[model samples]
Target: MSKPVIIIGAGGHAKVLAESLLRGDQTILGFTDPDASATLFEGIPYLGTDAIIFEHRPEEILLVNGLGSVGDNRTRQAMFSSFTAKAYRFTRVIHPSAIISHIEVEMGSGCQILAGALINPGARLGNNIIINSHAVVEHDCRIGDHVHISPGAIICGNCTIDDMAYIGASSTLKQGVNIGKGAIIAAGAVVINDVPSYTLMAGVPAQQKHQLQGGVK
Candidate 1:
């Protein structure tokens, strides 16, 4: 039997997630969002608020966290933790168009690897991560939980990105660079150094713009 999936957000990212799931031939039960205006998501029904998950048995349907993190990933992480506490299991959504090389790749639950993304061999991705469209993860990279490697971002070989880090669109991280937890790498920035925790790095060579005290809000 095909496992039914309930998507947790009804936004643009949810549309992408829906398309990925559909391409994988997975059955989608519907979406859950607080926005009553969202009656339909990419032609999929909106199954009311997120509280609706309590109505279904967790074991019977898997969850897909459609909430995307532009900077702060706490919302996505919170949703995953909440659902997990309720004994709900999450599904990893990988687009058919994505290229996965013959490498030892380990992915945690609730990850979304989008179309045109390339995950090289010997890479490890943590829970609730977003490898957005056309993003490239080179060999031996480690990406942490709730990290959003935005569209077209290139993570070079042997890089380490810690939890809740957001690498903006088209940004490139040099090989062997370490990005600390909760750091934000700006769009188009080229990172060549280790970023400190909760730091905002921008510009070419990626200087620290500011420290995100207490992390992203």
Candidate 2:
């Protein structure tokens, strides 16, 4: 049998990724976290920080941020860049329970597809993207790199979700809507139009509350 792959991050998100990777026929060597007081999680050892990546020399590693909120998305992007600069390869993980159409779907490394997530045919998922449990990506949706589709969010057909975008829990995107990069759609928002980048949108019809760079509304 091949050696298990390494996983970065040891928090709640990492836990889910670990299980998903295992279910996808990938071995988890261990986890790397800044705080490693705990010995094991889900029966896997919590190794020290990224230093172990160089020592163990696993074939590939998965980058898992698992941090909630859009603010964490920037942090995860930086972390992934740093890891790649150090010449470490990353892997994409998808749970076996998820339903994906046979159409061509492009996914970046370290992506997590949780149980009950349905990705329809012709969908493109970027690197390090997170399709949380039960999220539905309808046909021809394009999800950019590092975006997080919160649990139970529904992305209708032909939607374009830009990089680092966060679709809050249970939010629904109408078909063909374009969500700009780094935009945050609040929980239960029903998006009927395009969302500008770096803005926070909320409410039933999903209107922009404030510009992220300027101030909160």
User: Which ranges of candidate 2 are over 4 A from the true structure?
Assistant: 1-3, 39-42, 58-71, 214-217
Model 1, residue 34: distance off in Å is 0.5
In angstroms, what RMSD does candidate 1 have relative to the true structure?
1.2
Candidate 2 positional error at 145, Å = 0.7
Clashing pairs in 2: 91-110, 108-127
Candidate whose lDDT is highest: 1
- Reference-based TM-score of each model: 0.97, 0.90
State the displacement of the C-alpha of residue 212, model 1, in Å, after optimal TM-score superposition. Answer: 0.5
The TM-score between candidate 2 and the true structure equals: 0.90
> Residue by residue across 82-139, what tens digits does model 1's lDDT show?
9999899999999999998876999999889999999999999999999999999999
Candidate 2 contains a number of clashing pairs equal to: 2
lDDT by residue (43-159, candidate 2, tens digit) is 677778877777744344444444444434877777777777777656666788899888797777767788899999899998878899999999999999888899999999999
Which ten residues in a row are the worst by lDDT in model 2?
A: 63-72
Which prediction has the highest TM-score against the true structure?
1
